[model samples]
Target: MSDPGGRGDTFCGINPEALQGTINSLKRDAGRLRGSATGFKTRFDQLGIDTLPLTKLLHVASWADDQLPMLRRRHHLAVLIDKGADPVLHYPNCPDMIMVDDADVSADPPKVSDVPDGSDPKLNADWWGALTPGMRAELTFLYPDRIGALDGLPSTVRDEANRTALSKEKGQLNAKLNKLRKDLAATKAIPPSNVDDVGGAIGGDPAYELQNKIDAVQSKLSGIAAVEQGLAKGDHGGFPHAYLLGFDTHKLGHAIVSFGDPDTADDTVTYVPGLGSKLAGAEGDISRASALWQSSNQQAPNKHVASIYWLGYDAPQLAANSHGADVASESDANAGAPLLRRFTQGLTAARAVSSPVHTVVLGHSYGSLVTGRAAVHGKGKLADDLIFVGSPGVGVDRASDLHVDPSHVWAGANSHDPVPDLPGPDPFEDLGGNASSFGTNPASTAFGGHVFQADQDPSNSFSSVDLDAHSSYWDSHSESLDNLAKITVGDYGDVTEAPQIPSDVPTSPTLVGPGVL
Candidate 1:
C-alpha cells in the first residue's frame, strides 16, 4: 500500500475514484476470464481431451483469448487450432513431433465387447486419459469433426473460444492425469511385509512419496513439458527428471534413466513396477519413490549405481482386482519390450560414462513381464544377473524357457503371495505353466532354466497366499534380496534349484486398476 514509489505526475493516481475504477476493471477482467473458461470446457469435452492433464491447454486458451484481441501467443495458437494456422508455420521450431497413434497396439480379445476400436475416454479415462494437448491439436488430431467445426465460427469468436477451451482443457487434463497416475501407481504398491529392516544397510524401506516430490519438483523447476524437453535434450545433468518416452495405448512410456555413475559406486539396481506402468508411474510409487536411488546412495555412499525404473508400457490398466499373471500376454509383453529396449540403451550409455557399470535388472510382478519382454526380444542379456521376485510370468513356464544363459537367472517370491497363483492360460505366450509335465510348485516358476538363489525371505514361512506373490519379491529377509545385491555387484548369482513353472486356468480379472504399467 506504500505509494509504490510514487512519482509526482507519473502515478496512475491516488484518488479514491481512480482506485475504485481500477478495481472494477480488474473485476470485469476476472468475470471475462471466468466466462471464457466455462465455455472452453464444454468444447474440450467435445474433443475428448482429458480435463486433467490439460493445464497448459487451458492457460494458453485463456491467454490467447485475452491477447488475440491484441495478437499474442494464444491468438496464434487459436489460429492454429481453429483456422488451420499450422503450428509449424509460426513457431518453426516445434521439432516436428509426430504424436504416435494409440491404435497401433495389437487389439486384445475384447475385455468387454461393446468397444469402439480404441479407448473411449468417458469409459477408459479411468485407464487411459484423453490424448495430450500436443497430440490433440498437432499430433494425433482425434477430433477431426471439431477441427472442421471451427470453420463455422468467425475469427474473433473462434480465436477466443479455441484459446479459452484449449487452455482450460489442457490444464484440467494434466491435473486429472497426475491424480489418476498417482492413484494408479499407489494401487500397485505392495508394502514389503517386514517393517523392521530392509535393503540390509538401507534401513526401513526408504520413505519417499514419489508423486509429492516429483510434483513439487515440476512446480519449482519447470512444468512437466519443460522437464521432459530437458531430458529429451539430455539437458538436465543427473537431476533424475521425469519423462514419458513414447506412448502405447495410453500415454505410458517405458522409461530408462541413468541414476548414478560407477566412479561413484560399486553396484547398480533396476526397479520395475507393477501393472499399469507409465513413464513416471513406477518411480511415483509411494513406497518405491526413488526407491532404487536409495539403494544406489547406500551402496558406499557417494559411489552409486545408475538405476532405471522400468515404467514404459507393459499392460493395460488392471481391473480393481486383477493380477499380471491373469492378464493377456500380448498386452503385457508387447508394451514391455520398449521398456527393455530403453533399459539396454541406458545400460550402454552407463558403460560409456567413465564408470564400470555393474548392472542388475530386477522384476516385481509385471516388472518381470517387462524383463522377459527384453529377454525374448533378445535384449538385456548384458546385465550381471537376472532376478525375478513376486513374479507371475517371465515369458516361460520353467527356468529353461528364457533366452539368457542359464546361470544368470534366478527367482524369489514373497510369502502367501497371490501373483504366483494367478492363472496362466493354455497355449500361453509367456513361459510358466502348471502342467505336471514340467513339475514344480505353481509359484516358483521362472522361464529359461534360470536358477533361484534360495527360499525367498526365509523369515516368513507358509506357501501361496492368493496373488500377492506377484510383488512379494522384496518382502523381508526374502531370499531374493541376497541375489539382488549379489547381482548388483556383478558376482554370479548362485542358483541352486532347477525348478519348473506351474500354470493354472486364469480366474483373475483381465484388466484392473487405472489402466497403465
Candidate 2:
C-alpha cells in the first residue's frame, strides 16, 4: 500500500522535509526583518531624527520587533510538528498554543490528583514516568504553575512550565501596574482635602493607597526582570543554559533557579541565602550561583556542574520590635527545614542515572540553620556534603548530630563577620552554647566540622567585624568563594583549612542579641 501521509511524515499529513525547508526560509525572513528594523533605527539616530516628533510616527520598526516573538513561536511549533513531538511538552509558552473550544473534554490529560500525593517526590516521579509524552505535555500546558513547582519532574520540563508561568505573571503584573499608575494619577488630580473631612467613601489618602499598590506591583515586576536577566546570561557567557525550576510572586516571593540541569549533571550544588533574601534581590543571589558555577566548572572542566539558588523558604528579616521568628530565632529554619529536605529528596528521586550524582548543599547565615535541620530531618543523610558559611549556627552543637558524617561537613567564617561569634541559647555550656542564636557554631572546634579559609579583602582598613564581610563570601577570586567552589566539586584536599573558633572563647562578652549584628 502507498503511504498517504507522504514520505517521512507519519502523524501529520505534511512532509517533514518540506516543512523544515519552509521553516528555514521563514527564519531567513525574520533575520532580514530584524536587520531592516535595526538599519532604520540607526539611520534615524544618525540624522538626529530620533528625537523629533516624527519619530513617534515611525513605528514600523517597533511593529517588526513586536512580531519577532510570534515568529519565534511559529518556528518552535513548526520544528515540533516536523519531529512529530508533543507541542505542550516542548513549547516555551503555554498561552501561545492554539486552543479549540470544540475539542473533546474527555481526552484531557491526567491531572495532578491522578498521583497519590504530588508533594511526595517518589510518587510524583513514578506518576510522571508512567505518563505518555502527549499526556505529560497536555498536563504541563494546563497546569504550568503547579507542574513547575513539583519537585520530581525533570528539570527541562519544570523550566518550560515555569517560564510560561513567569511570562503570565509578568504580563499580569505589568497590566496591574499600569492600571494602578492611572488610578494614582486620577486620585492625585483630585484637590487635596482635609484628612479629617474626607468622607468614608473616599477613605484615607486615596492617592497614597494607590501609590502603595503601584509600588508593590513594581517590586514584583522588578523581580521578574531580574529573573529574565539571569536567564539571558546563559546565551552569551560560557555558562550552561539557565533553568527556572520554580517561582512565586506572593509576599516576599520565592524562586528556584539553576545554572545547569541538575538531573543530568555529574555534580550539583544548591545554595540557600540567609536573612532578608527575597525575590526582588534575586539578581544578586542568581549572580552568586553563576559565580559558583563558573568557579566549580573551572576546577573540573570535564565534569558537568550545576549550581542552584534556592530561595524557596521565607528567610527571616531583621526588623525592630521583631521578637520571635526573627533572624535570631530558629522559627524560620524550623519551618523551612522540611521543605528543604523534600527538595533534596526530589533531586535524588528525579535522577536519570543509576550511578549516584555528587550533591552538595551550602547555606549562608540563617540558611545554614535550615540546611542543618534538613540534614537531620530523617534517618538518612540529605546531601553528600554540607557547607555552612557565615552561619550563626546550624541548630546543633556537633557536626556528628547532622545525618552526614562529621568529616563531610564543613564551615567557613570570616574573622570580620561577627555572625559566627554571636552567642547561642546557652552562654556557658561547651557544645550547646557555641552558636550564636540557633545552636552550635559549626566552625567551632567543638562542632568537629572542617573550617575553611573565608577572609574578607585584606586591603580594607576596617578593624571591626561588619556586614560587608558577611556578604563577601561569594566575591569573585576570593578565598572564600574558591574554597566553596572546591568543596562543591569534591576537591576537598585542595581547600585551605582555617582555624576553628576556640571552645574556650568567652561567650559572655559575645552575648549581644541579634538585630543585624
Candidate 3:
C-alpha cells in the first residue's frame, strides 16, 4: 500500500504504522525467511532491492529475533494467575509457570506453597537453570522477596528484582500518605463542635486516624530513606557484574552486595566484615571492595576479577554495656558458617564446568572467626584460598585442621596490630586436653601457614591515627593492599612477609574490640 504523499505505506505486505509495529512485522517476515532456504533471495528480487535500505531492513528483521519481547508472555501469565483464572488450563505450554500448578498460587484460600525457599540446593540449582532471563525477571517482580534469597540466581536478576520491589512498596506508601492527607484536611475543615464529640465519626476520631496513618507512613518512609542512603553509598555506576545480592529495610538493615560475579569470574574475592558491621555501614565496605576490584584489575588486566563485600550474616553489634561486645564465643561464627559455605558453594556450582573460577575469601578480625567456622565445619571446598587479616584466631589449634590446605591458607597482620596479641586464651580444649579457646591463631607459626606483611601501622609514620593499625589494610600506598592485589591476581611470589612477633609476649584472653566500619 502507498500513502497519498507518494510514500510507500507498507514494506513487503507488512504495515509500517509505527516503529515497533514495523519491527514486529519485519520480525515475522524474517522468521519465515529463515525457515525457507531461498526466501531471502526471492523477497529481494520481488522488492527489486539490492541497496542499503534493503540491507538495513534485512538486518532489523534478523535482529528482532534476538531482542526480548516488549510484552513478556511470562509477565502476562503472572497477571492472569494473580486473578482467579487458571493459566495452565488455558495455555498448556505457558513455560514460565511450569513449577507452579493451579493449587500452588490459587488464592481462594492460599494452598501449601511448592515454590522453593532457596534452602534446598539441588532444587534451586535446577530452578535457576530452567528459567530464562525474561522468565526470571517476571518471577522477580511477582516474588521479589523469595527470588532474591535464592543463591543460584544471577546477582543482576536479584538486584533488578529488589529495585522493582522497593519502587512498588514506596509507591504504596505514598498513595496511603496522600489519602491520609486529604482525609485530614477534610476533617480539619469541620468545626470541633460539629464533629460528633463521641463516636459519630465515620472512621473514628479523624485527627487520631490521620495522625496514626501519617506516623506509619513517615516510619516506612524513614526506613526506605535509610536503605536508599546505604544503596547510594554503594552505588557502583552499574559496572559490569556489580550487584546487590540482598536487601531488607529494617532494624540493623540487612543487605548483601557484591562488586563482581563470583560464579563466572576468573578470580573471585569475598570479603567478610567484622564487628560494628551493619547494612547501614555498606558504603564503607563497598568502598573497600571497589578498591580491591581496581587493584586486582590493575594487578592483572587480563584476568576477570570479582571482589564481593559479603554481609550475609549479622555481624556482632557494638553496644556500650552488652555482652555482644565479647565476640570470643563461637556462637555467632558457628551460626553464620553454614550460610557462608552455601554462598561459596553456590558460586562454584553456578560457574561453567570447563572454566573453573578461583575463589578466595578474606576475613578481617571477627570475620576471620566466621571464615574459620566455614572452613572447618562446612563440607566441600568453600574456597581455593583463604586470607585472614588482623585475626584473633580461626577457632582451631592448628591450620592443618582447616579443610583447605595449610599452604593455601594465609595470614596477615600489621606489626603493631593488637588483635594477635589481644588478651585471649584458647577457649576450647583439644583431645590432648590443651586449651584452644578462640581457635588456632592463624598468624602463629604453629598454625603452619604463610604469614604476609600488612604493615598498616601509622604510629611509626607521620600520621597519628590510632585505628590505622587495625583497619588500614587497604590504605592508599599501603604495602598490605598491594600484596592483597598481588594475591588476588595469583602473583604470590611478590607478596611481602609478615614481621615476626616474639612468642614470649604476655598473653591474655583474646578479647574482641569494637570494629570500625
Candidate 4:
C-alpha cells in the first residue's frame, strides 16, 4: 500500500511486497552477512578492541540492509565496524558500567574538600578515583561519538572527547574531499586527442564517476561544516566557556552543548528546544541559551549560573507532505527521555553538597514533552525546578502526576502561540493514531502549575502573534525573558504570573503560519 503521508517512510517503511522481497534477499545473503560479521570480529581482535557488541550489531544490521537505502546501509555497517576499527577506541575494563561507588571514593586519598557525599563520583573533582590521568588523557584520542554516548563519565571528559571527535571527523573529510578534487582536476585536465574524441567523449566520460564521487564527498563535507559553523556562531568569550556535552553527525544529527559548567555552577538551566530542532540549526538554540545565561546572571548578580542547550533528542520533523498540525508524538520523546533524565542526574551528582547546584529544566515547544517524559519516568532526581514554555502538551494529565512538586513546576505560553492550544488526541481512545495523544496543557488551570506571564507584543494581538511568537519567549526585554531569568536563578516570587485562560475563550489557534517552529 502506498502511504499518502511520509509517516510510513519515517518509521518502519514496511510494505507487504517490499517486505517479502527484503526478507528473501536477507535469507539468500545470510551466509555472506555472517562471514562479514566474523571478519569484523577478527579485525577488532587484532586491534585489541572489544568485539562482542560490534560484531553482533553488524550481523543484525546486515539482515535489515535490503530494506534501507544503499548509502544508509553502508553507513550502518561503517559505524558498527568503526566501533572497533576507530583509531581512538577505548574499551572500559569492567564487565559492567558502574558509577563511582561511595566506598571507592572514600577509600581513595582525599582529592578535594568540596567533594559532595553521594555526588556523581565521576565528576572532575573525583576523576582520579575512577581513572588515572594517563587513562583520562588517552580517552581524548578516542572517537567522541562513542565516548560522549557513555554515561557515568565526567562532563569535562565528555566535552574533550566530543571536541576531539569533531576535529578528527573534519580532518578526515577534508583529506578525502581534497583527494577527490585533485582527481577531478586531473580528469578535466586530460586533453582530447581529436575533435571527434571531444564530441563523442560522452560515451566514456572520464569525469562521470569522479564527478559523482566528488558530489557525494562534498555533500558529506558540507554537513560537517554546517554544524561547525553553527557552533562557531554561538561561541561566547569569557568565564563561562562553552562545553560540548554530546555530538553525532549521523541522520538528522544531534548535539548537547553548554554555555557553562553544570557540574560546578550554583545554578544551572538545561533548555530543551522544540519542533524543527536539528543539529544544523543548533547555533540559534545555543545563542538563546547564552542569552538566558547572561540574563540569569544579571538577574542574580551574586550567584554563579550556567545554561545548557540540549538537542539530544530526535525531534519530529514537519515533512514535505505534513500539515502543521499533529506534529507532537510520544515515540521521539520516549526515546530521548532517558538521555535527558541521565544528563540531569549526572549534573546533580557531579556537584558539591556544600554548595548544591539548583537546577532548572526548561522546555520550549515540543521539548516540553521530552522534559516531562524524562522527569516523570526517569530514575533518581532529574531537576530541582521544571519550566515549560510554549508547550504543545506534556505527556501527563496533571502537574501532580509529574514527579516534581506542583509548586516547583512552572508554565508559560504566549497569548498568540498556537502550540499551547493543541489538545492532542488520547492514543487509547483513538486506535487509528491520527489524533493528538499528548496530555492536558500544563499551562491550563486543569493541569495545575504556576502559570507565568509570556505576553507577546501588545501591539500584536492574539490573532497577529503568529507561530514566531512561540519561539520569542526568550526575546530580550520581553516580560517572558525576565520571568525566565528570575526563575533560572530560583527567584520564584519575582515571576510575573499569567492568569489561566477563561473557559469561554477559544484555546486553539485562529491563525497559523505555513510552518510550525
Candidate 5:
C-alpha cells in the first residue's frame, strides 16, 4: 500500500511521482528503440532487404509518444488533487485498485451535485480535488460554461473550458446577428405607408429596434474576437500564455484574461478597470495586463509574475446604455464588491501549495471603489496589497478601513487627472456639503496610504485637467508603471513615493482650482 501522508507517495489512489517516473522511463526506452529501429532500417536498406519490421517498430514508438502526454497530464492532475486534499487518500498498487485506463478512472465518478456552491472557494477547491482526472475532463467537456466560470478551479482547466464556451458562444452570436440582419433588411423593404405603426406607438420604431439588436450582437462578436486575439499571442515576447478564465456576453459583457498561470506564479496582480469598460473594449485592458506582466517580470526577473485583466463586473457607463447604472454612483461598485472578493479568494484557494503567491489587487478609476468595497466588506483579507490609481475614491475614508495594513495600501494619480478631484457624496445630506462620489480621496494625506508618483503626461495648463492623464498609468516606460511593478513583486523599498494631496484643499475646478482658494 502507498503512504498518502508521505511526499512522493500515492494520493486518491494514484501515485503521481510514480507516474512521472514511469513516463520518463518510457520516453527514454522509446527514444532508444526508435534509434535502434532507424539504424536497423538503414542497414536493411543497404542490403536491399525490406524494412517493414523496423517501420512497425518506429510506428509503435510514435504511438508511445502520443500516449505519454495523456499519462503526464494524469500525473499533474494527481499532484493537484494531493495538494488540495487535507488527508490524501491512498490505495494499494494492485491491478484491481489502480486506475489503469480512462474507463477505470471514469467508473463510478462522483456526481456533479456533490460539487459545492461557487461562492465558497475552499469548498470548491476540495470538491475539485476529490474528482478523478477523467471525471473532471468529462464534466468540463459536458458543461464548459459552468466549469469555466467556477471559482477555485485550475487556470489551465478553466482556460480550456472557456475556450470551448467562447467558440460555441461566438457561433450562437453570429447566428443571432445574421437573423437580426435579415429581419432588419425585411423590415426596411416594407413601404413606409404600408408598414404598421403599432410597434412604434407601443415601444419604438421596428427598424430602429432591429438595428439596436444588430449592434448589440455585433458588439458581442467584436468582444469575442478581441479575446481570441489575446489568446493567439501565446508566450511571445515575454508575455506568458493568455488564459481566458471567464467570459460572457450578457449586458455590457464580462471577461477575465490572465497573462500567465496564476496558480504557479510567485506574484499575481489582478487589475480591475473602471467606467466605460466593456467586453468590446477589453483589448485595451488585456494589453494593459500584458504590459503590467512585462514590467513586473523585468523588475523581478527571477520571480514568475502573472497579471490578470479582470472585467468580471458590469462597470457603469458615463451615459446610459442598455445597462442603466451611472458612473457617478456607487451602485455598480457595491454590486461588484462581493464578486471581486470571491474571485480573489478563489485565486488564493486554487494556488499551488509548494509555491506561495504574493497577490496584489489593483483597481483603476472607478474600479478602486469596487476594490475598496470588496476589501472592506470581505470576511478576510482580500489581497496581500491593494493599489488604486487615478481614482475618485475607494469607498472608504481611510486605508486601514480596507482590512489591510495601511502601509500595504498604495495610491497614485497624475497631478492633472481630474477624476481624483471629483467630489464625493454628501456626508451630511441636510447640510448639503459634498465630497468624493465614492468616499475619501485615497491618494490624499488623510487617507494614510503611501502615495506613489504617477504624474505621467502632465497637463501643460494648470487651469484645465488633462483627461488623457487618467488612462496613461500603464503606459510604456512610465514611472507609474514602474512603481506598480515594484509594489506587485513586493519590492517595497524601491518604490518611489509621491507627495500626498491635502485633505482640506478642494482641488476640483468647480470648487477651488490649483491657484484659487
Candidate 6:
C-alpha cells in the first residue's frame, strides 16, 4: 500500500514531493499550471510561435493533426509548429512571468491613497502583485489561509477575503498586460497614427515599411519549410502562398488587374495577380488591397459590384513569360477561345436576374487579347466595357475590328509605356491581321470617353506613369479615388469631385519625355 504523507522504500521511485515541487514551481511562474511533460509532445506539433498561447491551446483542443493549420497544412505545418512552440518555450521563461517578491517595482510600499488597490489580498499593496491573473488569484486564495487563523470568523473576515481576491485578480491582469506589451515590443508593430492620411507621411517613416516587411517575413518564414514538405508529399493543402512583389513587378501587375475590370454599369472585374501574390505580406497583395479600398469607396452603400481575385493559376515570372498574352499561353489547343469562354461562363453563373449584369470586360496586356477575342466572336459575348492597357495586341490591331458596340469600347495608355505601341497580335497567324487586317484600332484618343486612372502619387513606386498633363486626373491630391468609390455605390447622378489621394508621389515623369506613344 502507498504511504500516506510518508516516504518509504516500499514506494516506487516516484517522489510525490518532487513532482509536487515541479508542479508548484511551474504554477508560481506560469499561473498554477502543471504543464505535462508528456502532453507537451502534443503541443510541439503546432509548428509556429503561438504568440497568443491561448490561441494555440484553442486550436490544439479544436483540431486533429489534419485540422492543425487549415489549408495547405502539410505544406505549412513546419511554420505553424515553430510559431506554436515559441510561446510555450519563451513565455514561461520571462522574468516578469510572475513576481512573488516585492523588489521588481518601486520600493515604496503602495500607500492605499498614494498608490492603487492591493489587487490581491496576499499582496498588501506590495510591489510584487504584478504577475498574472491566475497568479494573483492563487496568491490571494493561499496567503490568507496559510498565514493566519479565521477562528470566530466575522463578516469583516469575509469582506477582507473578497478584497484579497480582487487584489489577486489585479495582479494577474497586470502580468497578462505586461506579456502583451512585451510581444508588441518584440514585433515592433508601428503605433497607429493619423499620419497615414497624408501620402508624404510614408516617406520619413522607414520604420513603417521595415516593420511591415519584417512582420511579413516572420509570418511566412516558417511557411517556406512547410512548402518544401508539401512539395515532397505533393500536397499543398495547408500551405499559405505569400508573395513579396517589388515596386516594379507590382507596378506592372497592378496595371494588369485594374485594366481587367469592365468600365460600364454591368461591368465585372476579374483581378488576376502575378507571381508572389497572396493574402499575406505580399506587396502585390497590398497593392491589390487598394482595389478593395477603391471598390469600397465606389460601393458607398447600395451598389452593384462583383470582384474576384483569380488566384486559380500560378503566375509566371517575367523571365519565363514577360508577355502574358503570348501564343505560349493559348497555344495549348484549348488556347484563346476556351479560356475566355470559361471566364464568361463564370460571370453568367454568378449573375442575379433582377440585377442582370451588363458585361464589362477588362484585359491587361495578354489578358486584353483574351477579352478582345471574346468580345469579337461573341463566343465570350461582348461586354459593355472593354479596357485594354499595356497590351501587345488583342489578336488585332484595330479597335473597330472587335465587333462590339464601339460606344462601349475604351483604351488607356501611359505616356511612355510601349505595350499598346506594339503591333496588335500580329504574330498569332491563326487569329487575324497577319498582314494588315489589324485588330481593333487603338481608341486613339486621350482618355476620351474613357476614365483614365493610375497612381497619382509621385512616389518612386513602379506602378505609376506620367503623361506630363497638368490636369488633376492623375494627381495624388485629386478626388479621383473618392469618385471611384461613389461610382461603385450606384450614385453617378450628381457628379461630385474625385476622391483625394494623399499627396506624395509626383504626377509627372522624372525626365522630360514624349507626351504620347
Which lDDT value does model 2 have at 439? Answer: 71
Clash pairs, candidate 4, are: 88-142, 120-349, 424-436, 425-436, 425-437
Overall local distance difference test of candidate 6: 0.35
Model 2 off-target regions past 4 Å?
Answer: 1-106, 109-117, 188-203, 320-325, 430-433, 460-462, 506-517
Compare candidates 4 and 5 on TM-score and give the better one: 5
Of 4 and 6, which scores higher on TM-score? 4
In model 2, where is the ten-residue run with the lowest total lDDT?
A: 97-106
Q: Taking the tens digit of each residue's C-alpha lDDT, what string does model 6 give over 1-517? A: 1233353533212222343454444334343222342255457556653345554554544343323222222212222222221121112333222112222111322232432242232233232224322233233244533211111112122223433433453455456545544554664444456247553234345555544544444444333323223222211232112111111112111111221222222444443332233323233332332353345434543343443333222332334433433333433212443434454553453233445654545554445555665666544345555655434445554555666655445554443343334343344531322211124324243222333443234443333343332122223333433333333333445334222212232122323122221
Which has the better lDDT: candidate 3, or candidate 4? 4
Each model's backbone clash number? 73, 3, 14, 5, 7, 57
Q: What is the C-alpha local distance difference test score of each model?
A: 0.43, 0.76, 0.65, 0.67, 0.78, 0.35
List ranges where model 6 is wrong by over 4 Å: 1-267, 272-286, 289-296, 311-316, 320-337, 377-382, 423-517
Tens digits of lDDT, candidate 5, 1-517 = 2443453644335566678888998999899999999999999999999999899999999998987866776665456445432234445444322332345343444455645568788788888887655567657765778888888988888888898899999999999999998888887543455446663312266777887888888989999888777766657875779989998888978899998889899999999998888888888889899999989989999998889999989887764333222456788899999999989888988887686789999999889999999998757788999999988788888889998999999998777677777655564521222245577778878788999998774433344566666787998888999999999999999999997666565444433122110
Highest TM-score model number: 2
Rank order (by TM-score, best first): 2, 5, 3, 4, 1, 6
1 or 3, which is superior by lDDT? 3
lDDT of 1 by residue, 1-517 (tens): 1123343443111222333454556556756665676677778789987665355455654664453332222222232343342232222232222222223212221232222222221232222224322233432233322321221111222223333433444466567657756764665443566233653222333233444444553442233332243234222433343222222212333333334432234565666666655444433442242434443344335454545444545445566766433455556566666546554443343232364666677766666766766766653363556676656566655554455566666666444454544444543533333321112322443234454543444455545343433444444444554445445655453423534434443212232223222
Off by over 4 Å in 5: 1-115, 193-206, 320-325, 427-435, 457-463, 506-517
Better of 1 and 5 by TM-score: 5
Which residue pairs collide in model 2, if any?
422-436, 423-436, 435-441
